[model samples]
Target: MSDVFSGVYEINSPDVVSEYFEDQAVILNLATGHYYSLGGIAGSLWGLLIGGHATDAILENLAAQQPQLVEGASAFVAELISFGLIRQARAGAPGMSIDVAWTSEAPKLEVFEDLAELIAADPVHDVDLEAGWPVLRPQS
Candidate 1:
């Protein structure tokens, strides 16, 4: 496998769900029942990544503007990859045209495991009709 980090990337979907609210983002991996939060530079980078900007393009632009943040940005990307939240973009994928303005602060990824059991709960079939979702049916 290639580790050059020179291609566009996309969200690992189906099992992963994410929402960006204002300056922050919340990402949940349904497969593992773990969630993550991103703020500051990390959120901005995630916005760009999901927006279809090429990894190399983002890094190059950041390097041209900030220079010092290249290392941190790369590490952030690596961390995202390690978390299985993103994957390389498919061929002929359309790219985003918008520009990304990153903050001076380093990127940060906050992982949360407190909600694993809650997230893993099956709201569809495991719920009591009287209590509705989030209320598991009593085991017989």
Candidate 2:
């Protein structure tokens, strides 16, 4: 079974269209017509924001899947928090909030899953799961 922080992201389903970066495999989400870039270690971190994994579990999964990036995880996470892309879930939740920035009404849960699958399949740059994080190239 996947852990809380398995880097598995889902979409808000309510509003947003995401695409992979051209120069790098990093993913970018355009929410409320705003662009959010998620690359290198942050790309994986963004994946978790979609809501499948718990914060701690996602961290644990990151450690197991990409040990090298583990050292940078905290800092990367901090940046995400600062960007308002991610926020504390609630007073007592074990997860963070992912601002999907839906302009319209919220979508059904299944739609989010579908979006996740699409994003996973179409990374901005090529990815090798067994390898460490991909080097984020300059955007063209």
Native RMSD of candidate 1 (Å): 3.3
lDDT at 49, model 2: 57
- Count of backbone clashes for each model? 0, 7
* lDDT of every model, 2 decimals: 0.81, 0.44
Show pairs that collide, candidate 1: none
Which residue runs of candidate 1 sit more than 4 Å off their true CA positions? 1-4, 92-98, 124-140
Residue 13, candidate 1: Cα error in Å is 0.5
Tens-place lDDT digits, model 1, residues 1-140: 12447788888898788998776898999988899998668888888887788887788778777778878888889988898999877852445554767668888889999878768778888789898977778889
Clashing residue pairs in candidate 2 (N, C-alpha, C atoms within 3 angstroms)? 4-53, 4-54, 4-58, 5-57, 5-58, 25-124, 25-125
Candidate 2 lDDT, 32-126, residue by residue in tens: 23345554545545555544545556556665655555546655555454434454443333555443222222111111233443344324554
RMSD of each: 3.3, 17.1
TM-score of each: 0.81, 0.40
Model 2 has an lDDT value of 0.44
